[model samples]
Target: MRNHNTLKWMIGGLVCGLVMMACSLSGLAPADTGDSEVDLQKTQLALQATQLSIQADQLAATQTAMAVPAAPAEPAAPPTSAPAEVPTADETKRVNNVNGVYFEYPAWLASDVAASIYDAPPPNADDPYFLIEVDHRVFEFQNYSLADHFLTPLINVYPLEEYQRVNPGAAAQITLLKDLISWQSLGASRPDGLPFLPIFNAAQSFFTKVEFINTDSVNGLRYLTQFQQATYPIQNGQMIYTFQGITTDGKYYISAVFPESHAILEPYDDFEYTAEFEENFLGYLMEIGEQLRAEPDESFNPGLDALDGVIESLRVE
Candidate 1:
């Protein structure tokens, strides 16, 4: 509606300008006419009328623009180009170390991903979370997020390698185990008594399940995967996740986490939604988790084909 009125005004302005220009060219009122004061007054009023009409049209257009109509039922996502592919293992020359941790990614992502690739700050300074976007056509609105699995590139390299030994026969398959972070299964204490306890306890309210998806090796580094179920959108994509990490011992490692969705509905903080949506979404998530936990079968896809190259080519410091 506003667009239509703006166009109308624009067209009218063009006509007015043309009429004024044509009158000036044709000499509609010559200086030597010797017209009376009354004629002059009438001409002045006519000009004033034309000016007023233009002003009115301008005012109407302005008002139409300022007036906010009802918002659309759902907002359209902004257009986005494909995220430049993260470097593959083949591109030896282009492979670049990322952030301060020095993990490696394919040259394509190193060159074409986010504008801040070269200097993008580490995602988590305290417990840094590095995000590597492989696909970009998956644009997000309020927050840029992506698919259910393989949402982002993740690599967790802990200082120790023996950590994964707890899961025997983990090399060829993934075993889903509960992590202590879950408020239900564990308490807020750690043996080392690091500062992580306060942080974990602080974050406990939002986090529900923290699962370990483990494997002993993927090429050179011991593979570690973790899924921390929380109210947050990233984990909300699936009630669980399957991730990739790099570790020598497994005591300390770097892991991947991809951003997922916003709370399903807007103004999402209302309790009315929490009871209904949370239960519904949780039920959905458990169903998916069951399938993922099943004996390693043909269905599991951790995006290894796309990620393994980058991981294998990693040049970690």
Candidate 2:
């Protein structure tokens, strides 16, 4: 009986030991799996947290870049100026004076036929003309014969005849003479006996040229003309001439003289001798007037009287 009891005790002890060992093993296995799962979850959570932190850092960097200010643009440059123009010397010295005039005479007196009537021929081949000088501002006659013959007759007879063919009247003659004298006075003062004529009755056509120049303290007006188809009646003929000149102080002076005669009017009964003689005498007067006006002797009475003493003293010897 003692042996059986001891054996039973030993068996019981072994059974208890095995049961404890089995329970412990089972518990250990489950615990190990749970621990592994928990560790994996922890690792994933850590990784996600790290990625969120990186994203926040990137956002902060972008905000900083956007807040920065942009630089300002530069201003435009200014424009340049052009150079000024200068005037020439000649342009500064230009003159302002200007004047003009015309002279007319019978065409017959300008031709050779008129020359035969005169004992002494005139100085210039072109007689019955006028002269012009810019310095003196004067126009003087060139032929005394032509002026006297035609000019005097027209003056004396035109008034008596009333400009008609038969009896020339004094009023008509004076009127014509005055008109002629006015034209002559355009450049200079006319002679005492010379009538002033402004209208060009004998001239068929006229031309003129003008130039401007400055004189000391005075403006000069220069005028020049070329006559065409001029006509006048002479002894048994018609007279024609060309004329030109400058005017100063409202007077016309002669520049050049020319005269020619052609048969136009027939001789009238006994009027021939008287007409011829009168024409010749008047022609001489015109010639003398021109000569006196041109270069009169300083010692002469009226000619010298018109000039200043100094100028008269300087006259050509």
Candidate lDDT scores, in order, read 0.27, 0.23
Error of 2 at 188 (Å): 37
lDDT of 2 by residue, 1-317 (tens): 11111122122223232322222222112122221111111010111111111122222123344565756867865757665544332221111121221123322222211110112223244321111001212222223233322221110001112112221221232343334434532233221121111122122111112222222211221222211121111331122222222222323222222222222223433343344544354343334323323443332311122212111111110
Lowest lDDT sum, 10 consecutive residues, model 1, at 192-201
Worst 10-residue lDDT window, candidate 2: 40-49
TM-score, per-candidate, Cα-based: 0.29, 0.16
lDDT of 1 by residue, 97-187 (tens): 4332333343433333221222212323332111211111110111122333222323333332232332121211111111222222223
| Candidate topping lDDT | 1
Total clashing pairs for each candidate: 22, 80
Residue ranges of candidate 1 with Cα displaced over 4 Å: 1-246, 249-252, 259-282, 291-304
Residue 79, model 2, lDDT: 52
TM-score for candidate 1? 0.29
* lDDT for position 201 in model 1: 8
